[model samples]
Target: MSIAEKLSQMGVTLPDAPAPAANYVPSVRSGDLLFVSGQVSSGADGLIKGRLGADMSVEDGAAAARACAISLLAQVRAACDGDIDRLDRVVKLTGFVNCTPEFGDMPAVVNGASDFLVEVLGEAGRHSRSAVGANLPFGVAVEIEGIFRLR
Candidate 1:
């Protein structure tokens, strides 16, 4: 029924919000919009890591991308005072995939995050998205950022 319950139904667990790696805050809000910093799949116990379509398979990249999405949501929850249910709409998402020069499955990899959000929030998760291939992404295979319009 609620977003948190939906996550539980899907067996998705949100980790503690990771601290920013640089000068940026994890999430910032101005007016009714909340912008989350780019989140890379990192610093968990033992996540598989490497360049997508190079050292990793498509499935791995997808998984990493999904992880990044959850990190973004964790930041959102923290920013909105530990309640993801308060978000009314996920407005936009931009994802970056670190891949080999010839890799072209970037969209599929990013779908991991897009799909995860939809599963967690149902209709509220729908959003515009961009999935781009990059030379590198903070040394990880996937990075995702999100913008949410909250109630």
Candidate 2:
């Protein structure tokens, strides 16, 4: 099935690619690689913000991470000239979770994005990853960036 069909099967509708809040572009292509900028959790309900291990549960944080992944896909679609099918494979993902210093479930939280990608792209979604605790920008709960190989 096409990427759009897969997304539809998954009950996902890609939102408009968000404009950069800063001076940097949302995504850039170099050679066959596309580098997507970090995306924070901001869905239909607005930014998901809270410090994990303090006021947010792992499940909630994971949901925020998933939202960030959706945003990443939106950026990737835009980068591919509105054709996500042009994506060859997911190369890597760097996730940042806003949490207390004592929190140590970064990997699990990031798995939210990882799992969703694999679900949407199957084998093409498997990729190297890094999940770290951080005081993310705008005080968002989770932030994620991705690198993709373009067809």
Evaluated with TM-score, which candidate comes out highest?
Answer: 2
Per-residue error for 112 in candidate 2, Å, reads 0.3
**Residue-wise lDDT of candidate 2 within 20-132, one digit each (tens)?**
99999999899999999999998998888988999999999999999999999999999988998998899999999999999999999999999999999999999999999
Sequence-dependent TM-score of model 2: 0.98
Alpha-carbon deviation at 27 in model 1, angstroms: 1.1
Model 1, 1-151: lDDT tens per residue? 9888888888878888988888988888989999999888764664436887678888888888889888988888888798988888899999999988899999999988998888888788999999999865357888888999988
Global lDDT of model 2: 0.94
Please give the CA lDDT of all the candidate structures.
Answer: 0.85, 0.94
Candidate 1 Cα outliers beyond 4 Å, as residue runs: 46-48
- How well does each candidate superpose onto the true structure, as a TM-score? 0.93, 0.98
Best by lDDT: 2
Model 1, residue 68: C-alpha shift (Å): 0.8
Clashes of 1: 0
